[model samples]
Target chain A: MSMINYASREINCKLVYYGPGLGGKTTNLEHIYGKVSPNTRGKMISLATETERTLFFDFLPVDLGTIRGFKTRFHLYTVPGQVYYNASRKLILKGVDGIVFVADSQIERMEANVESMQNLYDNMSEYGYDLTRIPFAIQYNKRDLPNAAPVKDLQASLNPGWPVEDAGQQKVVPDPAHPGENLVDRVSNEWIGHAPYLEAVAVRGDGVFDTLKLVSKMVLKTLS
Target chain B: MAGAASWSFSENDFKQIQQHLLAFLRDSNARCALLVDRTGQLVATVGDAPQFDSAAFASLTAADFSANDQLAKMIGEHEFASLVHQGQKESMFLADVAKRVILVVLFDQRTTLGLVKLKGKGAVESLTKIFEEMFNRVGAGPGGQAGPGGTPQKGLLEGAEDEIDKLFG
Candidate 1:
């Protein structure tokens, strides 16, 4: 569900960063908090244990430049990646307008990544918003590390709808099969189940802004 | 109950009213007061918690209240009037306005519940006037066509009716 504030002429959308434990969801937010201009970003709130596992989502509201004469604000949140925290994850996804799934690229974390994605879908399904229908993107973090999955293989397995095409490749689809398929197809069907997937090292800030830009475009498009 | 006595609000009028409200809340020593649409988007917020994510709080609270509304309907209870969540350090109180916008107040346990309720009611009274104008602007703008199920006014009435049904069913 979208929230339109007539008074402020601003649309505030929730974008949750989701992934498996230690997948860099929180680290991704910390990098953005450091890089984004102070004026456009809000306080970054994190509830984590002493060892730094996220207890709840870390929230940061980023204000993108206006669109169609209205201020565009994106509320960025990161869900607790630990598997047992499904309850908190569902709480965070409430009223989310978009999602950024951060998958750790280490070969050892593949099962955890898949399980987390499946959890994301199940939680979203309970709310009647297909994970694929909402504006969303993916970031395969730890790309710079040893044993990172190749983007080609990652996209093949994660984003079946939008396969990795040359940069700026254009693809279109009509009559998307699943409601979630629409969001996936907007970028590519090859990435459908795997839509909005990107490669990056979140700790180092690779591909972060690109992911933000893509999500912003989808949000504005959804509003209009 | 005559049409001659009814009040009307315009766009320009609402802007001024909303600004005044921000100022009023600021003066009242309230940490933050949010005018949220039924969907929980913060139409306006007052006081400085620049570090606080008002937008996310509003969205989550709205989702919580909406889910509670459904729950109320399922068990033959009245529509959810308000929900107050109190923790050791923080407390959140949510109130509905015209069944369209929700007023969310965030405060420390130091603030008295009575004080928040009083100020919240005042905020709602002031906001109702602005909403009346907003309704007018939506009607007069562009094609001036009504929303689904006819005019926005009709939709507003129907929305209220639905709320009532859930409350009394």
Candidate 2:
């Protein structure tokens, strides 16, 4: 849910960075945290363990200038990628306006990517949000690595195309338990599940800003 | 979890909330108060607050209160009414206002938790009334279409691209 506070003249939106473990999600945030000017950024809080792994999420609030007269405040969050942290992931996904699915391009991490993507879909299902429709983008990270999967194969497997069955997504009928049945019915079914892809090496800050810029624009467009 | 509620607050409401928080501070002998949303946004702040990163504090407080709520559920309780943090010099008392907002009171040895909680109740009453009116106004506003003042909400990304370019430059 995006909040437009007329009193403060600020527009607040939540964007989440989600992916498999060690897929450069946190590094993306860290890179942004380092680059953003202090006046435009806030404290980057990481509720991590002694080993510095994200326990819940990494939160960074950025004041992205003003739209009309209202200041645009984007709250960035990165969920813990470890599988057992599903509970924390669900808690973090609450009221998410957009998502950046960071896919590690390494061949060895392909299974983990799919598993995490399914986890994202499943967890989002619980909150009555379908990722396919939401303002989402994809980042093929670790592209500089030697054993990276081709973007074509990644798209064939992950992207929901016109003719093929959307893996694990065919069963996404309207949830009966959800409260807004009529509203859901009224919403357009033209949600493109797969989003524009960006090649990134988050550690080096390559393609990081592009990912943020695209996701930010997509989320803001949804608000419009 | 905040479910699809876009907030629309008027300037008058902010003034009233600030007044209530000031009164709460004087009565409770606390140093500062902050109204934080569950998503870790610092809705408002008042009083002789400590010199710290308020954004960081807001995020951590929301996270702490959330973790505490889950812990309470594990114990089979609905929720903890207040979270008290004790330090050698400063003690912070945080209370829930309508379950959607948090009221945090920062104090030192000059005050006690009992006094803060006692005064916090009256503050909560006033703040709750203010928030109730605010939320009602939001409810009356058509889903993210117009604000309480009947002004059409502006598009979120209008001119944002230029701003991003400026920031990067």
Candidate 3:
């Protein structure tokens, strides 16, 4: 849900960053926190274990300037990626306006990635939120790792298109970020659309803003 | 796409809410009062709150309240209606208002917990009524659309992309 605070002249939206354990969800937040002007962000809170693993969630409220006099604020949250923390993850996603699934690109974490992705779908469904109908994006993180799986493999496993049930939206759609790649295309007998995705090395800040920018725009587009 | 519901508060609504909070503060003698959405958005604040990150406070308060609700369910309770956290110098009290928002009061040596709770009950009642009326006027429910005064300005988000680009430019 997005809140339009007419009293304060601000619009607040919640965006949750989700992924498998150690997949760099927190790192994505840290990079943004470090890069954005301090005046534009609030305190970044991390509820983590003693060893620094996220125990509950990490939250950062960012002001993305003003849109027609209303300050646009995005509250970025990263859920604990460890499996046992599903409860915490669900709580954090209670009123998500958008989502960025940070998938670990390392070949070995493929199963973990798939599990987490399925878990996301399940939890969102339980909340009565249709994941396919929300502003969702995917970030294949840890691309710098030597054992990173090929992009195609990760796409096949994670970003495989969802059925495009709307006839008006069934046409082929090109991915503006990735020339020659189609974000929505016909598969077999049905038209399908994939979540827009990008590669990132969060720790190094690569593609961090691009990923944020992409999802933020998608969210704003919804409002428009 | 799951069209996100927008919660809009007209200026008059804010005035009414703030008036209730002010009266609550005077009655409770608490240092500060914060009205927060259950989903972690800070709706309004009143009284003399200490220097702290209010946005973060709202987020944590919502999380804390939520976590406690889960705890309540595990113990066979529907939900904990309110929570009190007593510190060495100050204590905070949180209560649910119509299950839509939280009423948080921060206090210290100036007041007693008994008084805060007594006054807080009244405040919650008034706030709940206010929210119920607001929700009805806005046509808000599970996945409901924004109504009339609750709708955003036309084209308010039209040039948002250019603004976002300027941030990282």
Candidate 4:
């Protein structure tokens, strides 16, 4: 949910980073917190276990400068990626303005990625949130790993387009990041739309900002 | 879009909210009070709040309140209306306001929990009424509308792309 504080002349939006355990969700947050100018960021808080796995969530509030005189602040959050933490994940998703699903790109974590993705859908459904309608993106993290699965394979498993039922929205929508690729197109006589995605090696900070920038733009577009 | 509940507070809305909060602080004799959205955005603050990161504090307070709500369901309760965290020197009380925001009051040895609770109940009632009126006036529902007038300002997103580029540039 976005909070428009007219008195303070600021707009605040919440963006959540979600994925399976150890899929670099927290790492994405840590990278952003470390990179953004301190003056534009707040204290980063990580509710993690003793071993450093996210226990509940990690939060970072970043001031993304001003747009039309309203200071835009985005609160970045990462849900605990472990399976048992589904409850915590659901709680963190309340009133989310945008979402980044950071999928582990390695071959071995495929099942975890699929399960977590399904969990995301189910949880969003419970809140009556249409995953496709929101400002959503996917980050194929750990791309630098030797055993990283092919992008096509990951796309097939995770980024398959959902049916675009509305005729008004069924037109071809190109993915600006990947020329010659359509984010929304007719498939097997059915219009389908996929969330825009980018590959990332989060630990090395590669593609982190690109992913954030993509989703942030989508969110701003919604607000505009 | 579902779950897109944006809340807009005009100058008049804040003035009224702050008045109530100030009165609550005076009556409760609490150190400070923070009106935070359930989504973790600090709506308003009154009194002598301790030096802390207000943004982080709002986020954590929302998380804490949310986690407690889940805990309530486990025991078959619909929800826990309010929560109190008592520290040795300083304690805080959090109450739900119209199910839209959290009313948090911070106090210390000078005030007793009994007094804070008594005053907090009245504060919550007043805050809840204010939020209800505001939500109704703005026509805000699950599908959020823009500010009080239901129109977004021009150029809100026109130069946003350039601003984002500068963030990393």
Candidate 5:
């Protein structure tokens, strides 16, 4: 249930950053907030503990141009990653329109990522929301870090349903001469169907826009 | 104590009461306590109920109470003093505090109704001072600004205009 504010003519959408603890969800948002035009963004408020852990949530409202004469404002929030804060997380999800599940790309965080995704699915079930119908994107972040899982391994383990092209299928293409360099072809070469997956070093701003563009498109599509 | 009686009705006095409420609820065996404005916006909360959706709950509860108030009016009563909702497992007690705010208590069935009402009396008396002070602050002509939306960051009431339509005729 998204709210459309008629005064500002801005359709306000709530997009939550959800993932396991220490998955860089906050870091990803901080990067985006810093990079976007200051006039289009508001103060980023973090209610973190004295130890630098998010105690409640972080709220950052961003304006993403206009859509059909309505200023599109997205209120970005991040849930406290600690498992004990599940109750507070549930409260934050009350009117969420989209989600960015920041999955740590390191090999060790695989289990944590799966567990957190399951928790999200369960919480949405409580509110009678079908997870597949909601606008959501996955970011395999920290890709620049050492010990990061290979993209192929991550696809197989975390996103088994991911649509990526197999090497055998690539041979049938016979395009080794010039190589399929189009964006759509590249995405299809990496996935099974047409789902777009972004790899990012979020702190350095790499692939950040790609993720943002995908999420913004998905959200607007859902609204219509 | 020169202005003690007038002070009793001021928001400054209400601050003292709000501080006391925190200490009072902790000792009362109640898990959480909230002071909700007549509009159902939470003025304060105590204990570890941050997980509770205070904003949404307050808005919905205010709607419920507003409907109840209308029902009371149909029965020829001017207003409702309090509402106590008890289910099999959990119970909520809402009481009016100085006609401006509602004091809400959430607890398990283990708590006694008599004890809760007695403590609520003391809490409400203290909270009345806070509400009076808030009224003065608000009535002092918007602290030099215009109405709510006049401030750059405050559109809290902008949302309320729509909310009012949902609550009352």
Candidate 6:
């Protein structure tokens, strides 16, 4: 839920980072925590197990400048990626305003990405949020790895619900009034898994902010 | 929230709320009193405690209440009306202000739990009325939002700019 606190004169929105284990969900948050100036953010908390794997979640609150008269505050949360932590994952999804699915781009981690995406879909429905309408973005992370799969194939596998076929008339569902000149530019337009997708190496801070910017823009747009 | 973003406050509303919060603090004699949305954002605070991280405290407090709510369901109760944590000297009292908001009071050796609880009930009742009026003025639910009668954007941007200089510099 997005909250408007009359006493504080600020708007607060919750954005969750979700994906499979070691797929850079936490890394995305850590990078944001490192780069943002201290005054712009609060302390980042990680609820982790003895092995330091995220046991519950990682949370960070950031000030995304200001929009309109309200100071825009985004609470970023990352759920435990391990499969057995589904219950904890569901808990984090409550009242979520937006979502970033940090998919591991490595060829070997492809299956985990698909399973995690499905889990996200199921968990979202349980809370009455439709992934199709929510401000949802995707980050194909670990792009620095040599075994990283191509972004096209990763999107097709992970967002199977979206149309990824690139041949014949079915490939191009351009709007009649505003026709897209070509396929490449049009692909990034409306279909973006309902938001935008970016290639990222979260650990190195590559495309991390871009991912945040994309989701934040979508979230603020929804608010307006 | 899924619909249009539908909450707002005027400067006068902020003033009215601060008066109640301060009055609550004086009555309870607590180190600080925080009103938080159930989603874990700190709605307001009144008291003098520079050592506390109100943001983190708000987040953890919301999560604690949520976990307890789940536990209540498991135990076949609607929910706990209040939660108290007693320490050697400083004790914390948390109560539900409105169904949507949580009120927390951190009191120390200067006060007793019974006194805090008694004062807190009165605070919650007053705050509930204040919040309900605030929301009703803004058209909180459904398609209504803070449209024409909303506060102007003139001074709020300047407010942040002033604070940024004081904190960061």
Instruction: Report the Cα interface RMSD of each model, rounded to 1 decimal.
Output: 15.5, 4.3, 3.4, 3.4, 18.5, 7.1
- Candidate 4, residues A83-161, lDDT tens digits: the string is 9888889999999999999999999999999999999999999999999999999999999999999999999999998
DockQ of each: 0.10, 0.38, 0.51, 0.56, 0.02, 0.22
Q: Tell how far residue B92 is off in model 1, in angstroms.
A: 5.6
Candidate 3: residue pairs that collide:
A133-B1, A133-B2
Off by over 4 Å in 1: A162-194, B1-32, B36-40, B46-92, B96-102, B106-112, B115-169
TM-scores for candidates 1 onward, in order = 0.66, 0.84, 0.94, 0.94, 0.52, 0.81
TM-score for candidate 6: 0.81
The residue-level lDDT of candidate 3 at B85 comes to: 99
lDDT string, candidate 4, B88-133, tens digits = 9999999999998999899999889999999999999988998998
Worst 10 residues of 1 chain B by lDDT: B1-10
Q: Model 2, range A145-183, lDDT digits (tens) per residue?
A: 999999777766665433214454543344222233211
Q: Pick the candidate with the highest DockQ.
A: 4
Model 6: how far is B61 from its true place, Å? Answer: 1.5
Query: Candidate 3 or 4, higher lDDT?
Result: 4
Question: Backbone clash tally for model 4?
Answer: 1
Model 5: per-residue Cα lDDT at residue A6: 36
* lDDT, residue A189, candidate 6: 50
Interface quality of candidate 5 as DockQ? 0.02
RMSD of each: 11.4, 7.2, 2.8, 2.8, 16.8, 6.5
Task: Give stretches of model 2 more than 4 Å off.
Answer: A161-193, B1-3, B139-169
Candidate 1 chain A, run of 10 with poorest lDDT: A175-184
- List candidate 4 stretches off by more than 4 Å: B139-169
Stretches of candidate 5 off by over 4 Å are A162-195, B1-169
Kindly report which residue stretches of model 6 are placed more than 4 angstroms away from their true locations once superposed: A5-8, A162-194, B1-6, B136-169
Measured by TM-score, how close is model 2 to the native structure? 0.84
